[model samples]
Target: MWIIGFLLVLGPLVTLHELGHYLVGRFFGVKADAFSVGFGKELAGFTDKRGTRWKLSALPLGGYVQFAGDMNPASQPSEEWLALPEEEKRKTFPSKPLWQKALIVAAGPFTNFAIAVVILAAFSLAYGKIEIPPVIAAVSENSAAAEAGLQAGDRIVSVDGRPLNSFDELSDVVLPNPGGKLTLGVKRNGRDLNFDFTIPTIVERDRFGNEFRIGRLGVASGPGEVVPVGPFEAVGLATVKTVDIMKMMVNGIGQIITGRRPVDELGGPLKIAKFSGEQLSLGWREFVSFAALVSINLAFINLLPIPALDGGHLAFYAAEAIRRKPVGQRSQEWAFRTGMALLLTLMLFVTINDVISLPIFSS
Candidate 1:
């Protein structure tokens, strides 16, 4: 189940991501030499008529597209690329215009985001939108809300001065701020009041025993109605959800960097496999939802301004645009090498962390 779930979730996502790059590159007349769904040794594949080797590799973690004149899968330009004939150079990625290159690189991450938005929109269409008011129905005894003087029947006006439209927005603010304090604006009996309190961090476990640390206000809102949504409205809502997920990802990474969140919270391929298996056990709906979340995560991670990533390529393009020339070849080579090293080190750390957190390793 674990292996199957891992493949089911990552296989399509990785393939689509690479396909985005391949399609965009082809659209720009750039020739791709290879399209791989995984890294390392090639397990199985075939060469297409266009000379592109479409293959499945041994490692199932991630994939890449190697374009013409590239040194390796990272898309570094080969030293001999400049010596290629004019016609050959025209079809290589390095010979493309800055905008075209950027678009080709950006397409991969954008495709992942699009996948997430589509999945979310489909869910919204099928199940309708949950619209719950911000009014507090109850506050738990001795909880953060209770200690902050919040009471039943109090309508939450805002959190930290941001106006609230629905109770669902509260989690958006709270979940990313474990142990952090916030000022709440509330209205009761036609009067306004403000209360400040610290959010409590709690460890939550799913039925499958997967654990998560999150902030809780210890307040409850009435069960909101699921209102049917039009196709357009569903798409709009899904876009908002996609953006919200991205915001949470930014917050989480910032917390980790600032020491607000533990480094161990970062998970890697193994952890994802575990989660995929667990979500698969719940049913297809839950599994699909998890897939959407993972898709957004892939998009988010790939769009970071780190070298050897899609965002890194875009960053170089931005610099090229400003400078009216590409960065020195030596500099790009060193930067990519550094980036690759950092990525590998981080992957190793997270994989070890994931292994240690597994049930077999738990004391």
Candidate 2:
């Protein structure tokens, strides 16, 4: 059941991505011959009345769309495309204006962003949202919170005399102040305990190859245990949630490039499936949140300037617009081949990490 749900969830995201290309390509008068969800041997499919072949393949991992005159799966056009019959050449993707081609490539990632917004809205409306109080759950041994005399069950009323509402607020205040002291008004057993503690900074990693420095108090915070918001308040809260996640993702990527995070944590299909199964067991809300996070990730990834991806193609089109001539085919082909090799290598590495990181393997 978990596997089935995972497939259904990922399938639409992949299909929507391909649909973005299909829609934009057709709008630009380029013929798209096939839009397929998944790869490998075809499981089931039927040619549409419009002549586009819609297919479901054996692997439920990812999907693609084949444009008319595309010479390969990477969608590179051949010399034949340039020499085609005049009437038919009009339908080739290479014949589109640079701006239209750029838009066609950019559509996939933007669609992922749209998916995130919709999911976030639905989750906020349905669940009323959970928020944790600014209470300390546990302090790490010999850590900053413990050294500052913070203990379990201390209801943090304020920091520096400012009233605190939720755990999210507390984190925002603390995360940037690692190894720095902050005044805390804690309500204990019928008494207000005023104290000062320095929060420690620890490095953490997210889904992307990025690292972040987070304040460590060694406590767990959750929804409603701290503060809760209603429906209208929830939308603003949801938007903030989306924005915060995006910031963390950006920071993580920075850390990766700076050598602060290792590549081992970078995950691929196996990691996603593992996470999907785990979230499925947790129920609908958690699964929805997971999906939202992945959606944001997809959007960011597609924006990267790597050949064979939306971003890569957009870069080429941008250059064409500026220089008044497309990049030489040989140069584009070499770049694409390099990009493909790098991508496949990264995928394989991440999958290995996923397998090795399993608890069963640890024992």
Candidate 3:
């Protein structure tokens, strides 16, 4: 079931990502040699009229589309492609204009984001936005809220002068400033009241043993409203959600790099596969939601300006655009080799982290 779930999560998303590259390359008049799901030896395949071999491979982890000029699945161009006949050169990927190449490289990540947006939108239309009221259900005894004179049934209108949309909005004010004072504005019996209070810091460790400090107001939220959204509204909301997740991920990465968060918080394929199985056990909708999250992560990771990624290709294109020529082959080769080494190291570290986290292996 875990294997099935893993495939279900990665299969369509990877296919769509490759399809984006293939489509854009074709649109730019570059011939694609193969469109493959997974790497290595092929399991089954068929050739189309355009002579592209579409194959399902044994790995079933991720995929790539090889263009006519590509030396490998990594989309690196070769001297063979450069030395082609004049007519054949026109059909090769490297012969395309800078903008065309950029678009082709960018399309893979773009497709992943597009898939996420669609999935998120569909979920919004189905289940609607979770709208928990800002009202306080109960203030914890001797907690910050209680010390601030917060009462049960008090409706929070704002925190630090910022308007509150839901109870979760309080985290925006509190999480960043542990042990710092905050100004809370509440609506009690048709009257506005403001209180200044200090946040109590709490240390929390995630599944991967990463520790973080957060503040707790010690108040439970009231009941929530489920507001159904229209298709267009859902799409817009999904886009915002996508952007917000990306921002959070970026911040999280920065935090890890700065030693504010642990490096073990990073997850590789094993962690994701476990999550896929867990989500699948819950239900199809749960699995789909998980898949959407994974798709967004893939999109975000691929767009990092590291060599061997789509963003790396786009970066090369940008340099080419400015210098009126591509970066030298030797330079590109060294860049990709370094990138591959870094990527492998990251994967190995995260895989070890994942293994340590498993119940069978844990202390």
Candidate 4:
């Protein structure tokens, strides 16, 4: 079940991500040397009429596309790239205008985001959107809200000066601020007021005993109604949801880097497989929803400013634009090498974290 779920969830997402790059590069007249789903040894593949080797490789964690005149799948320019004949150079990725190169590099991550938005939109269409009022119905004793002098019947108008239309928006602001202070704009008895307090942190445990640290204001919302939305509204809501998830990811990573969150909170492929299998067992809806979350995660990770990733290439392009020339080849090579090493070390750490959190190790 685990193996099946992992493959089912990751396979299409990774393939489409690479396809995004391939399609855009092709559109710009850049010739692709190879398109691979996965890394390492090639398990199965075939060459196309355009001489592009489309292959399914052994490792299935991620994938890449190698453009003409590229050194490897990472798309670093080959040393021999400059020596290529004029006709051949024209087809290589490096020969493209700077803007075109940036678009090709960015297409992969944006494609993942698009996939997530589509999935979420489908879900919204199937099940009406949940619309909850921002009014506070109850406040937990001694909780953050109570400590801040909030009471039942208080209508939350905003958080930290940002206007809130629904209770759902509150979580988007609060969840990412564990142990952080926040200001709340409230309306009570038709009078406007403001309250400030530190959000309380709580450790939550799932049925499987996995623990998560989160922020809690300890206020209960009124029972929300399901409001049917049109297709356009569904897409808009899905886009908002995707952006919210991305924001949470950014906050979570910032917390980890600042030592506000434990490093063990980070998980790699093993953890994903475990969750994927569990969600698959639940039903198709759960499984597909999990896949959407993973898709957004992939998009966010690849957009980080790290070398050997899409964002890294975009970073170099930005530098090129500023200086009006490509960065020195030696500098790019060394930066890529360093970035690859950092990624590998982080992967190893997260894998170890996942393994130790497994049932067998826990027992």
Which candidate gets the maximum TM-score versus the true structure? 1
RMSD of each: 1.8, 5.9, 3.4, 1.9
As a TM-score, model 3 comes out at 0.87
Off by over 4 Å in 1: 40-46, 58-62, 72-79
Query: Model 3, range 89-151, lDDT digits (tens) per residue?
Result: 899887777788889889999999999999999999998997888889988998888887899
Quote each prediction's TM-score: 0.95, 0.75, 0.87, 0.94
Better of 3 and 4 by lDDT: 4
Q: What is the lDDT of candidate 2?
A: 0.76
Which pairs clash in the backbone of model 2?
A: 130-223, 131-223, 131-224, 132-222, 132-226, 133-225, 133-226, 210-252
Instruction: Give the local distance difference test score of model 4.
Output: 0.90
- Candidate 1 CA-lDDT value: 0.90
| Model 1 agreement with the true structure over 1-363: per-residue lDDT tens digits | 788889999988988998999999999998899999889999999998888999999987668888897675445567698788999999999788889989999999999999999999999999999899999999999898888788999999998999999999998898878978899899999999999878899888888767788999999999898899999999999999999999999989888998988898999999899999988988999999999999999999999989888888888889989999888877887888999999999999999999999998875
Model 2 bad stretches (over 4 Å)? 72-77, 128-214, 218-240, 256-259
Worst 10 residues of 3 by lDDT: 205-214
Instruction: Pick the winner on TM-score between candidates 3 and 4.
Output: 4
Clashing pairs in 3: none
